[model samples]
Target chain A: MTRVHDMGGRFGDGPVDPSPEPVFKEDWHARALAVTLAAGALGQWNLDTSRHARERLSPKDYARFSYYEKWISALADLLEENGVVTRDELMAGQGAGPSPLSGRKLRADAVAGALARGGPADRPVDSAPKFAPGDVVRTRRPARNAFVAGGHTRLPSYAAGAVGRILHHHGAHVLPDANAHGRGESPEHLYTVVFDAAELWGAPERAGDEVTCDLWQSYLEPA
Target chain B: MPHDHHDHDHAHAVLPPDPALRVKAIETILTQKGLIDPAALDEIIDTYENRIGPKNGALVVARAWTDPAFRAALLEDATAVVAELGFYGRQGEHIVAVENTPEQHNMVVCTLCSCYPWPLLGIPPGWYKSDAYRARAVREPRKVLAEFGVTLPGDTRVRVWDSTAELRYLVIPMRPEGTDGLNEDDLIPWVTRDSMIGTGLPGRPE
Candidate 1:
């Protein structure tokens, strides 16, 4: 489905104001980010799961909230949905008892270590890549509201059905569509496909410009 | 239509709903549940705020400019090469370093979400994560570049990399001219945050 979160190339976004700004415009933004990260370190869900949770909001809420605000709200829902915390306790602003998952909590000294040794998504796969660097490919075009189980998809809406050439193979990685759901880590050969900007936007004047996207094998078909 | 006048769905919405207060409440609840460590949150915030940032990326660019072998290593295997310099972490896994040339200029964006090399360039800028950038960078990069005051030559091919998967992209912007006499350390100041992101070029040597 072309969810609100996937709004690439949907016009009327207006000119980008690339003004210089601080990392966190407000103090709460930092707290919100750190809290979300710390809670995520509890081993309750994976990165893809967190991303899906953020995308689960209603169309109205998703459009209204700020970046970190969405993070904070999604985290609250995940904490309850994953059974890490109870809704009643969250409403009461007090724990019913002692913290259950003490062993999994990230401590202060270990924060840097955890951030350094990131959760690597690359896994061993028994299959070889089907396409090479020079092969031409076309992205899978799903009908609007018809996608892979209606879960998280890395293929932006704009690239659907667009033709491009494989620039390089990025090795087999976890397929987010399956991983975001409860399905297993279905690995797929990922490749960088380069598309001419003119072809992407149907503009003849922009012939020299190009755009490259990192796509999984399933999202492409030989052209 | 007016049955639910108030936001009864999110109980907190009934409150003032101030972002700061809302975050404080969530942190308090998670702390009470023992799911989050307050100290860890502080550490994560402090580390990103002060310790890690664009300086690390600038240093990497400087080393690449001074050492051809290092630049080759970077383009070949950025994850391993950057790790050798003690720069490796979350949101930066499986990096691909694309160099910018006069013939083709490279820029990076995440149309799906905000996926940046945090260990190197730190948190993404506000504009980088905006809806406008995510929507337009992949579609009309030349126009986007012009808005950033980056007026490229008419012939230079603009290559926009829309980061969609686990692999993060880092643009090796072309080194500024007239800085041939500078050392690696001296070259560090020439690199800026936007330069690495492919939005703005590095400043001239002072």
Candidate 2:
């Protein structure tokens, strides 16, 4: 469950490089962004599903590919998976037949409008929020089944099993774990959980430090 | 179309680098399939670069520094307040403005992935998306901030916002000292991208 992508607190990561460059380094990077967004606008998969497709890659491949390269790969995978584009079409860089979803094109003029009207994950739920602001809570220890399954999860590895206090109740939002799997939007209360550095990383690392995370109700319990 | 002239030397010389060629090939294929409009691609790129960038965020910070009412509105309902100024979309659909004061500072990071407020801040810088930052930010934020040349007072509390959900964070960096005479327009230049992200402070006027 804890993949290389989830490297929150564990060390050995090299020093942060402060190189300044334009958003797209190469031409393909821009194309990668465009193609991914275009494909995504067709409504074949949600954002979480797109993210999971990239996370599902082998660690070796994930490490080797640049950020846009990962997106391009994921786009290709999703195209084939959704029957929008075929594997042979991707390999040959040409369509073998008419696109399956030819009618679902996002026009050039609609780009800005579509992005501005983002798909908000918030959904109405009947149950009231369990925790309020200032309530002490502890992060649930990540279950072995979910971790070993290697499915999409919003709970970062570093925050799991950590104790925190609720800073705010963010109302009900779609659970990303379920959304990624095509499960219904099992909406839940989202809260801003504030953890002391001492609680998360232990002593010497303490001192005037706190980490706040937007956690779902399922990830927390009363401390 | 160019692939037809496949003479070995011409192929080697005329072909772009691997990534460029790969992207070109994909673009051409998608265009042929009628999946993506080239004009739309250009529009998206233009929107991010020219229309929506850190300047929009700088303006918001500048206004917040000068107008208490706007600041209150931002802290209370960031999404609506920012949209009032015409900066709302995509990653910025839900935003919460966290203020940095004399006693406390705020920083933001997406531990799981590169989640940034594109409508306000444009694309995130390379360092924000780096593995080093993702790991160290929540663990040793002081050290990371120091690396960004932002050494705070020993007693100043550092609050790191890990963006794990839909709500994005924008750090309303503390106004620098000695800028009492500067108007809102003049103060816009002081608000840097890193300042909004809480990695560094706004530039103090000399």
Candidate 3:
């Protein structure tokens, strides 16, 4: 579904302030990240699910929250949905005690190695790639009101219906649009498509500039 | 729905609007629930806040500048080359090194979300994740680069890598001239975080 997080070519954004920022602004920002990662080790949800939870936030809340705040809200929702904790427990600051899932926790010692060998997204597919490098392709424009329930997708709105040439074939990877809804990982051929800035924004001054997006085969159609 | 949110406080205090207080409450509850170990949480926090960061990526860039074989290997297979140097982890399962030269400038952005090379560069900079950068970086990169005090030559081409998927990119920024005499140790300090991300250039020899 189209959300505020799908911001790409839309205008009226504020000017960027290029300044060095601390890794964590407050003590809680660190906690938010760590708790999210630690709980994520539970294998209750995947990265795309956590991302869709944030995007599902009301535009008002999404705009109001700081970066880490967004993570906190999403983690809270994911925790509740996965039956790891209850809203009452959160309000009470203590659960009905730990559940059986509690025993499967990430220990302090494994943190370094676990993060180093991150979960790989490239899964092997049974079928051959549909398209290869140098193939021109177009992205599908979704029908209106498509994302009724589990409308999790990685295709940003700006690139929808845009035609571009593929520069590289990245092999089979998980398709997030399907995976976000508890749908099985539908591995698809992934390619990096190069679009001219002028093609995306229609600005004459952007003639010499180009933009590239890593897209899954499911999003593309032969042009 | 009243039960779904802690809005409208009872005789008890509702979760504070302060995010710190809210996160505190969630953590306490999650810990008590046994889903999160306090020690594990500490380790994760310590690692990002202190251990992993741009210095790791800077080391790779310095090696590419000093060693031709590493540069070729980095361009050929960044994920394997970086892992060889012990710099492989989350958000960096796959990496493609894009080189910047006088004829072409490259910048990286995740317009949809902040999908950065965290293992290589640590947490993304504030601007890289800001709404403005997410919207304008892909739409008008030259303009965005200009705001960052980067003025490319009129003939130079601009390339914006919007990595919305799992394949992360590290920009192999062109090494500044007159630094040929410097060793990799001397070159390490010249590579800034933004330089590796392609929003800026390497520091000139001093």
- Sorted into a CAPRI-style docking class, model 1 comes out as medium
Listed models, DockQ each: 0.55, 0.37, 0.57
Candidate 1 lDDT tens digits, B1-206: 11122235554443236778878888887777676788899999998999889999999999999999999999999999999888899888888888999899999998877889898999898889888898888877778888999989888998888888888888899988899999899999899999999999998656
Task: Give the per-residue lDDT of model 3 (tens digit) for A1-223.
Answer: 4777888887899788998779987899899888888888999999888888787766677788888888887777777777787768766767787678977788899899889989789998789988988889998685111333436677778888888999999889988877776777878899999987777778734577888989888789899
Candidates 2 and 3 compared by TM-score, better number? 3
Judged by TM-score relative to the true structure, which candidate is superior, 1 or 2? 1
RMSD of each: 3.1, 5.9, 3.1
The count of backbone overlaps in candidate 2 is 0
For model 3, residues B21-81, the per-residue Cα lDDT tens digits are 8788887877777777899888998888889998999899999998999999999999999
Judged by DockQ cut-offs, the docking class of candidate 2 is acceptable
What does DockQ come to for candidate 1? 0.55
Instruction: Return the clash pairs for model 3, or none.
Output: none
Name model 2 segments beyond 4 Å from true: A143-148, B1-17, B204-206
TM-score of each: 0.95, 0.93, 0.94
Model 3: how far is A104 from its true place, Å? 1.3
